[model samples]
Target: MSKAPFLLGAAFVAIVTGLSSIFIVDERDQVLVLQFGQVKQEVTEPGLGFKLPFIQDVVSYEDRILGLQTQPLEVTLSDNRRLIVDAFARWRIDNLIDFREAVGAGGVDAAQARLGSVVSAAIREILGSVPLNAVTSDDRTALMNRIRDIAGREAASLGVEVIDLRLTRTDLPDQNLAATFARMRAERQREAADEIARGNEAASRVRAAADRSVVEVTSDAKRQAEVIRGEADAKRNAIYADAFGKDPEFFAFTRSLTAYERALKSGNSSIVMSPDSEFFDYLRDAQGPQQQ
Candidate 1:
């Protein structure tokens, strides 16, 4: 009966041992097998793994690219401009042996803390040297490359390789935002004023040109009318001279009748003058007795 219980206990022990001796390393993880806190094996590939039961433990970190973001850091540019910059870095553990020794069981947290210091230092050094315009412009690519270089050099000690470094956000500090807006608004208003002034100047010039065109057109019309009137007067004078040269007495009679018609054409018209008046010369001549 005692042998039966012992045999059952033996099977139980074997089952437990089998379970504890086996572990798995995931495809996304890099595992370091630590025996009593000392690294014994580094498992980078994914599959089933084994270790001494009850004596060894496993620590894992991501073998793929990992992102570590830094809190907002303030930097002063060469032009004395203050900027708040937040950046992130893409990194992975390259030297697993060194990582195990330095980070121990803290894993990604310890690595991130150490890496953040390096990145912050790099940002201050490279970003602080350039002007704000450079950081805000296309030249920022070169600046990021330089920051990555500096950060990568410092990260090597922690068995980390920074593949990429980027500034996620860069902006003026909170206190400066209102001032920046005010300056921009003022600049826009100034430009608007200048545009209004230019438009007014152009309109004035157009109005002056139109007024001058009106004067020129009016003067030309008046001159043309005077020339037509003068031509009509000259034609009438020539006709009268021709008529008088052809027949003197008939021309004089026609002139006398025209003057009498003007003086007495209306019903209310009256001439309070003697019959011998020149105005009646034509009537008097018509009424004279017959002569040879």
Candidate 2:
């Protein structure tokens, strides 16, 4: 019975040994087999892998690209402008052996931390040499590419390759926001004042032109009325002259009658004159003062 217990324990240990000696590598992972903390085999492809049981072990790292987001960093531009900047990067391990050697036991996490420092230094170096407008303008793309190139060189030592780096956010600091907004508002107000002044000038010109037109029209109408009135007076005087030329006695008789009618229009009218006055000649006889 003691021998039976010993045999069962041996079988269990053998099964455990077989299980430990075998490993399965997924397509998404790159594994390193280590013996006494030294890398023995680098399994880059997906397959069944084998290692010495109880003496060798495997460490797997992600083979695909990884992403990292940096904390907001303040940068002073060449124009003496301070900006808050946040950036992100895409990276992947290019040399598993070098990556493992550099990061040691900390692996991907340690590599990411070191990569972040390199990226930050590059960001400061490139952005510090340019003005604020360069960072905010279309030239921003070219600037970022420069940063990536600088960061990529430094990252090569850590066996990390920077696929891409981009500035995720660029903004004014909280302390400068109000000042910038105030300056923009003042500029807009100045432009609005200029537009209003221009509009007023245009309106004054229109009003002046309209007033001039009104004066010209009034003067023309008054001149035309006077000309018509002068023409009518000339026609009436000409008609009177022709009638007087036709019969001087008849014209005198008619004029005297018109004067008498006006002088005695009202029943209570009184006139102080001599009895043989020319005014009474028309009443005395049908013949006028010419006969007298």
Best by TM-score: 1
Residue lDDT tens for model 1, 1-292: 4699999999999999999989999999988888978889989999999998999988877889999999899999888999999898999899999877777678789999989988999999998898988998955788999999999999998898999999998999999999989998999999999999999999999999999999999999999999999999999999989989898777877787788778878687667998777677667777532345
Worst 10 residues of 1 by lDDT: 283-292
TM-score of 1: 0.78
Task: State in Å the error of residue 234, model 1.
Answer: 4.5
Residue-level lDDT tens digits of model 2 in 1-292: 3699999999999999999999999999999999999999999999999999999999999999999888889999999999999799999999999999999999989998999899999999999999988998965789999999999999999898999999998899999999989998999999999999999999999999999999999999999999999999999999999989899887887888789778888788678999998679878876455532
Cα error, candidate 2, residue 261 (Å) = 9.6
User: Deviation in angstroms for 277 in model 1?
Assistant: 4.9
Reference-based TM-score of each model: 0.78, 0.77
- Give the clashing residue pairs of candidate 1, or none: none
What stretches of model 2 exceed 4 Å from their correct place? Answer: 1-11, 223-292
RMSD for each of the candidates: 4.2, 4.3
